[model samples]
Target: MTTHLSVRAPDRDVLSDPGYQAYLVLRVVFSVAPVVFGLDKFTGLLADWPSYLAPWINDLVPGTAQQAMYAVGVVEIVAGIVVAVAPRFGGLLVAAWLAGIIVNLLTIPDFYDVALRDAGLLAGAVALSRLAVRYRSVQRERGSVA
Candidate 1:
């Protein structure tokens, strides 16, 4: 009897699989959540937010919390849009920004919960970045430039 040999290769269509769909959902949620929070900065939906900054942020900015909030709102909205649409560079930007937020949250003892929440979000950002890169690479390999 002749010897038999088998070689296994990766599934090329993995990017189009249901797992990728889940990734898309998670990415969209992560992107949109920031937009909502960013808008709230302008609207002051969280009654405690301004007061929470009454001690430190005010001293740092000096009569400029509202202006600073507006700037942050604009940036967050733009970043959210980028993540939802562009994905590639957007993911990188989101991940970097989230890292900064996480770092800041860690400095405040009362914000430990927020810090933990951001840690989870940071993981999601990383996952989205990987998914975007993987999908792009797969498309390129398959000769379908997207």
Candidate 2:
């Protein structure tokens, strides 16, 4: 009797295949989520995180909570654009920004859920970065780095 064994290889061939789709999905999701939330920061269409923390933000940030909100909006919007247009650096930037948010959330007890979500999003961004790095490396080896 002959038995056939199939091995899922992480070699260049497998990495070159549709496996990179995972990266694209993560990239798009991370990119879009920031854009959406960032827009809400400006438009107040979504739940206003600031209002919830208004009582404390003034005491914490020294009369700069509103400015901080706007700044966050700008950062998130820019990060979103970067992630959507420039995949290479965007993933890393988004991951870093999300890490900052996670830190801030850790300091706030009421916004734990938002912080957790941010963490999950940050993980996705990291996954995208890893995938992007792997794909780029594979492409460079093949002289087709995109």
Candidate 3:
């Protein structure tokens, strides 16, 4: 007697999968939003970016708050690029960055509502990280011969 083992094809289309779709949406949003916001830091078209900096944090860093914002803009641009190229790590990077922002906002009495919004963003970042982990493993498995 011979026994047959069945294996599913590795080339299955994942675009239709709900999880993959969610992952793609999140990846794109995370990739774009940060870069746009980062650019705005220099242009100040959105808001006075430096004014959002907590005084304590400003004192801790050298130079003025605006200078710090310039540095932040660079970091944000880099982070967005990372998310675009390698979301598996980028998601965590964004989450960590958001955590810092949350702490900074909490220090400012007038920005609690903004902090709350950032907290929501932090959660989304965390979710993206988790989803990235799942999809990354799936991709690796799909690339390998079964």
Candidate 4:
């Protein structure tokens, strides 16, 4: 009597996978963009950051519009760092931040265009979060995650 043994093929490299490649691109972009924008809030090279704040939001906060923007800059910087370290949660954080920005923009006159743009960004953040979930699962199976 002869016995045959079956051998399983090794899994494909995740780096070569297209979905993983997309996730990497999104991860890098999401991680860097917010940090850059957040820093710019202090420099004002991009735009007048204070001008973007809605009057209602400014009133609700305990400071002037510019002061509020300073706080916003801090939050954005932290969010960006979080994305670099843990994208699964960072993406949701960015999405929530964008949602707040959208609502604020909608309340301001002549800022509807900005609100629409933020909505698109919000969608991208959500996508990143979903992709991170899949990536985390793969990492867990590989014993790379604790």
Candidate 5:
């Protein structure tokens, strides 16, 4: 029986090494920042995160705005972990999440600027995702874990 090696014969992947470094930086920031913010959600040490929720949303929620934010925090924590585990797709998830936040802020009064800022972050997240795909592809070609 011929035991064929099914794995792709991989060599070193040096394409866009510098660019991959940028991807790594973005991955770390996006991954760790959410965990930090999610933890802060429980303590409310950074800011009154729930207060930022639109008044209408606060009313729509079953519980206090704080409780809604706790849920948001949980989602953020999971998203952050996802980014750490799978940045290629996770960055896109974060970007989508930011787009939703931006939309929410746009619905609220006097938060257009914050929404725009988040839009910028969303762009960064997109770039990170694209770059990460290339980086991950390289890692796979190299037959190594990043």
Candidate 6:
């Protein structure tokens, strides 16, 4: 005779809502990505990012494109930190940053795909903002229920 038993608990699916999972994943991604890319701007360990800057934006900045990228790096780092602490507002900041990136990529020749990708990322950040609000409300309700 053999005994059959369930090793997995059915109650463990508490956080299994796909939308909630996606929102959580986006939170982590948006949190870490900007920080990593921003830090890379200073190190150039990834690439000399200034080379990707549009000539038009370069013209507007007083110093070198590298200097402007350094400034961008600082903003990106702050955005990541803000997202980590408060995604509701930070998501909009990231969306704005992505919009700026999209515009910049548009100015460069032969980078339409990258611009398109940034646009998608911008949309995701916006979605993340909405999702964060909803998730917080649900969490509050759950807390009250408990």
**Please, what are the lDDT tens digits per residue for candidate 3 over residues 61-89?**
99999999999999999999998888878
Candidate 5 residue 126 Cα shift, in angstroms, is: 1.2
For candidate 5, write residues 1-146 as lDDT tens digits.
88864554334346346787688789999999888988888999998897679887788879998999899899889989999999888899999999888878998888899899999989988998898888777777677665
* Winner of 3 and 6 under lDDT: 3
lDDT against the true structure, each candidate: 0.72, 0.75, 0.87, 0.87, 0.84, 0.86
TM-score of every model?
0.73, 0.72, 0.87, 0.87, 0.86, 0.86
Candidate 3 vs 5: which has more lDDT: 3
Cα deviation at 112, candidate 4, in Å, is 1.0
- List candidate 3 segments past 4 Å from native: 1-13, 144-146
Query: For model 1, how does the per-residue alpha-carbon lDDT over 25-134 read when each residue is reduced to its tens digit?
Result: 76788679779978988888764455434345557774676776777678888889888887777777887887777776666669878878877877878788778787
Which TM-score value belongs to model 6?
0.86
Candidate 5 lDDT at 8 equals 48
| Least well predicted 10-residue stretch by lDDT in candidate 5 | 7-16
Clashing pairs in 1: none
Local error of candidate 4 at residue 116 (angstroms): 0.8
The TM-score of candidate 3 is: 0.87
Better of 3 and 5 by TM-score: 3
RMSD of each: 10.0, 10.2, 7.0, 7.9, 3.9, 9.0
Per residue, candidate 2 scores C-alpha lDDT tens digits across 11-70 of: 566456785768767778878988888877777778765754434445867556666677
Query: Candidate 1 lDDT (Cα, whole model)?
Result: 0.72
